[model samples]
Target chain A: MRKNRSPKPPEPCLLTECMQVIAGAWAPNVIWSLRAGPRRFNELKTDIPPVSSKVLSARLSELEERGVLVRHVRPTSPPSVEYELTALGEELIPALEAIVEVGHKLKQLRGYEPASEAAE
Target chain B: MRKNRSPKPPEPCLLTECMQVIAGAWAPNVIWSLRAGPRRFNELKTDIPPVSSKVLSARLSELEERGVLVRHVRPTSPPSVEYELTALGEELIPALEAIVEVGHKLKQLRGYEPASEAAE
Candidate 1:
């Protein structure tokens, strides 16, 4: 007699959702800068050069909505706002670190060095 | 007297490079499917529904060029080709796993269930 077997449950495509969070061109750079600490909008703009003010604001809002980052409004003559990573966002660091490791390995295999390093 | 201090060397942005590999919309899905084993072009297309033939072929070629996957051509009456992950590609699995874990947490926090589960 054949024993009955239950079909395996369909695993949700979690990686796809995660990738959506970081798919923005400047999302990783923004997250990387915030790893040091929280920053005001202007500070973030300064830290991540080449990103326009409009785009930066948009990405920040997107991250906040996704729960990856939090927006805190400070009470002052002019209310100051700062953005920082949430617990959920912090959880992404290890994965980012792993990606970095794999990326370095790929670069090494391809014999492609960063321009700054090449200049040095 | 101030002691001489060597400047910290600039670290390369490995995450950016890694992101380039998976930047394509279908990249993660393709990589995830390949995790099981090698597959032919047609097999991949079938596995990843909704992707057009042109886009799928481009993604395959791009992945192969990035050193993430290898394309093997088998000699037969009609040559058969299969694509499989390289060691570097295999290295990305852990990172992907981590991302998936974080994604699940995010989705749970949002109280959003997948459509399949919602149907049940």
Candidate 2:
């Protein structure tokens, strides 16, 4: 039998660490879905239709490990689980919004009138 | 033999697409390093010491593919290449800075005096 041992954690590089925390292939989609409110696993799966169940689960675990999202499991007849951003995660909104702002800028710079007045 | 066909590009989600462009393993480090000015490939490799040559190359290719970073080749005797962020990529700084700001806030909320006043 092979021993399943975790490799030593990489010494988190400052900037890369932050990006990795937010940059999972499906992470931004997960966070954006949660931005509306807390969600169940199924709800998130629906929000990101193309993500496979395995990929969604892995992304959630990664986000949870980074302390970006909280997972709550309720004790009941049947288990119910939900996920939401912690205060730290909520704080990331500005950064996400900033990215959107840049996208809007790029759009406008390409000669399209900005569609969203709120971005500026 | 397995064909070297590239995977179909993921349908770019709005926010996820932007994050993925900047969220590469060593991408932020490369961007931050370039923020000082343009840099050669060797300089970037040195800036991110922990990243393997293959990983760095892959990340560079991904960023270039996304049009975030530009790669230049010089036909000198020794051959030279340099990288710099396109205007759109440089525009991502505000978002990165916002993440650092949130980190500083998290640090303070955890009861350590914020070390950086510039964040606020």
| TM-scores of the candidates, chain A only | 0.73, 0.71
After superposing candidate 2 on the true structure, give the runs of residues whose Cα lies further than 4 Å from its correct spot.
A1-13, A75-78, A107-120, B1-12, B75-77, B106-120
- Chain B of candidate 1 achieves a TM-score of 0.75
Q: What share of the true interface contacts does each candidate keep?
A: 0.41, 0.28
Residue pairs clashing in model 1 are none
List, residue by residue over B49-118, the lDDT tens digit for candidate 2.
8878898889887777666678999998778788888776687777767666665555544353222233
Candidate 1 residue spans exceeding 4 A from truth: A1-12, A75-79, A112-120, B1-12, B75-79, B112-120
Interface RMSD of each: 7.6, 13.4
| Cα displacement (Å) at residue B116, model 2 | 24
Task: Evaluate residue A69 in candidate 1 and report its C-alpha lDDT on the 0 to 100 scale.
Answer: 85
User: Which structure among the candidates has the greatest DockQ?
Assistant: 1
- Predicted model with the maximum TM-score: 1
Per-candidate clashes, comma-separated: 0, 0
Best by lDDT: 1
